[model samples]
Target: MPPQTREVVVQKNVPATMRDGTTLFSNVYRPAEGGPYPVLLTRLPYGKDIPSYTTFLDPVRADGSGYIVVVQDVRGRFASGGEFEPFASEYEDGHDTVEWAARLPGADGRVGMFGLSYYGKTQWQAAVTKPPSLLSMVPGITWGNHLNGAQMRGGAYELGTIYSWAVTTIAPDILFRRYRDDPQQLGRKLPELVAAIDTLQAGGGYDVLPLTKLPDPDGLTPFVREGFERGVDDGWWEQLNIDGRYGNVSAVTLHIGGWYDIFLGETLRQYAAMKEVAERRGTAPPRLLVGPWTHGNFGSTLGELDFGIGSSGILLNYRGDLADYHLRFFDATLKGREEALADRPPVEVFVMGENRWRGYEEWPPPGAREEVWHLSGGGSLTREAPSGEPDAYDYDPKDPVPTLGGSILMPQIYRAGARDQSPNEERPDVLCYTSRPLEHDYTVLGPVWVRLFAASSAPDTDFVARLVDVHPDGRAIGIADGIIRASARESYPEPGVISPTAPSPIKPGEVYEYRIDLWATGNTFRAGHRIRLEVTSSSFPRWDRNLNTGESGARSSRTEVAHQRIFHDPDHPSSLTLTTVEG
Candidate 1:
């Protein structure tokens, strides 16, 4: 840890003028006795004074560690001037803020950025502009593309997260700003909004029809409606998305993510893109750290499972805390004390089941072989191909499967991470294919996917694939999962590449091949543990339910019952592909 040799001073609501002359507010923290220290800036839509926003790194501590820290509210957010349209003004605003922060009273004109989630995204936006004074950044649990996994996944709306976040997290601020001057109006409307938020928090209101027209009577959150009305081909997403733009970022970066984070896929994509840029430019390669954590929870326990204390971000592998990791990287890059990071590895990942951290020179750890497990008759997953009768099930939109676990962002009631899948497996709609107990520890270290030859009786539908590790004690724990919308199957041409413009509806009752990307996972399936694959139609509320009517989910309330079939014949060998690493 850096020495706390200096006392810290703070200034609140400091204003910085943007290129458009709009003023944004920030809180500045600086050492009482210092001669122009390096500055660390974080811009976020969340309140600057909110403790939750600063959970990863404390600004006061950063200031005391011989640095000036500036935490700013993004435009249209708390204390900042301008209308709030998510991600629209981030690039320009972020660029302006970085330059302004560089010129702060105690700043040495060299700036580094740090924050989690949306704040992490702000760093990317600014870095893409190639801000002259920006030297380094650490973007944690953030996304590179907005549509791929941030807002929509597999061409299906992230209904649970989008609704809960907008209603509970974003609306309060919008309401506060709207009625700050009028107590009578605020009193009359605040309770109604609170009631709606409370309903959402308790896992209600998600079933409302015509998703685009949720109960926003005051029209406080127009973005929610716009998100639904806009098609994937619409140019609006370009303003917010960072796809194909990593080359524009010149700052050295450290990408941090969690196994169960909602944006894990895009986080990995961003790292790979930046790493490619670094290799081409002959600059230092970016670092990566992935833990067995969820969206904002960095603790050891997630869902029903408890990874050991070594997996905790606070005391990671008993080496240091997250703040220490950030400071050491900043010291190396911003202060030119390269020795501070000499022993750090380029890639550090927490391997679950093994419950230990592993260091690697690159991701996917080299020498991983692709292993195929075929889906066979008698509900078995085998190494050899199989010939069997197709399995069929009826899917009802009204009785969609509940969201149990995996990489999902929703209300606290719906926990995220590894959880028991026994309840879901019992449902008739879910098809389970199980492997016999493994004789040796099987380690999977890279991307996972499933290939299925199936037929549906509806014009459009959805297919979800989940990977599970079945314990000897009969516990079915979810590891990773993915979903694909039938009509929008062409959106994802490959594992990580997503072109969400085109949609081709499937022919009813005609067999079609579908590739379901389960993202990636790093786990050691211990001996005597069984590997299980689950195939289903919906993981409700996590991703919007497909109505099977070939219409937009946003504007339609109609429902349908679809009969789905899974084939496993010699010619149509449905299988699961796993990237395995040998000991």
Candidate 2:
């Protein structure tokens, strides 16, 4: 038998108190050996299936990785006694849970937390409180942005993902029409979503959204009704930034986020905020590992089988490669392990197109300078703008540009290869900009931003940019992309209206500068690889439909068609600015 093997022992039904007299349930997982060890706890919205653990990060590994494990249900979840309100009592409940777990029979008094997603949120909550016994955390693929930005991007609420999770997983499928009052009140506003969640406390004891529109409640899942009514970006999202309040948490964190994850921004934010706290407290910030992946599974290939040649050199698991390294970190911090004491660089990111890992001293690197590639005729992108013969494309919001190339969720089988984009350029609505087949590898990192000058025949429109790699053989695989509504040109905060009182049809010759963020990417423009930029006006379903009327955009059930033109000359300087590595 292995000397470090832990005996299966659990103290069930243990209770910890929240400030409001609410109680949280925790089940402790500890070593059979009677020696003291540092405590590791995770408080989550998920049930602590004492029979089957909910977390993927191994606590037994923490035995070899050297720590005690405790998994607990957050307030109002499982056996815990209280009403479950998103982010409302997580901070207070986590503080109590961690402090209590640290005093378990063989606890060393120092505590750490581990988990992902909602579990990860609990860690941030525990750390933010600067709990007396809490020491460190390994939060993976989680977000503090509970609504608006986290679940929905650009006000596009994720009706399918959220509703599916609630109805299918929460409880026995049942009818709960009590929440049908949301749609009218919220109209997709933040406060309304919270009220919707509050509506769950009604007589039937079901969660509901604020003024949520449950057009088909009779057929809809319970989660759907609750999510719709609650789909706003109100202060309910403050939990996403609890790390900002961590002057009390000097724990060394080890941050992890996947390249294809929806929570990439939060992972980055947590690391940055933790680093600030550690600097002032004379400790180092948490180490970070961003892998080329979608969602949680890391340190492994995407699916069941490898794609052969394309997936040559990659770390299948960040945990195996980095855990021992991190253990050395905790050894240095918690046990004075000398080998763990060393200074490392600031950041690491998974470069997508390149399919490799790279490091940097800071994020949004200061070295980020722009290299503009102008759009030329005949689907060409060159340093030189097309003269006399400018390429033209017409955009109709009715049949807007389809979705392609970006950090999104879908099976890998359906994702098109970089050159797959070649066919999309065939459409009249998409403007193609391609550089001649690359003479050598052109790798780019950092956020890809595009600046375009355009005008529409209608008051409102959209500008979508797709970054692609067109292979010499005509394979246009998507890399990354972004979308911006024309009416909200001035700010995301204000989705403005054009000709609000009097509808003025925009003249074709009118010019407007549109800045669109293509998010981030790590790709190499291989020799013979033609770098392409496909510009269109919509990414349907992914982005809410744009009501081309401009003034009543996105809100009104009605939509109008708009004609858009792209200009690329001295008169209209349209260009794409990308961050390229020295390679």
Local distance difference test values of all predictions, in order: 0.89, 0.60
Provide the RMSD of all predictions against the true structure, rounded to 1 decimal: 1.4, 7.9
lDDT of 2 by residue, 1-583 (tens): 6574456566777787767787777777677776688877877765687423333455556665566778787766667787565566777788888778888788889887777777887788777777878767778777655432345544334433353344333321122112325654324343433343343322111212221443232333443444443323344344444534766676778777765565665676667677777777777656776766555545334432122232221322233344454455566666666466454455666665556557777665557666889876566788886433545456654565544434544223323222255556778788778788788888777667677777777676667788887767677777767666565454333211111121233444578777776656667778888888888877643454555665432134455666677778777777887887775
TM value for model 2: 0.76
Off by over 4 Å in 1: 1-5
| Candidate 1 residue pairs in backbone clash | none
Please, what are the lDDT tens digits per residue for candidate 1 over residues 278-338? Answer: 9999999999999999999899998989999989989988989999899999999999999
Candidate 1 scores a C-alpha RMSD against the true structure in Å of: 1.4
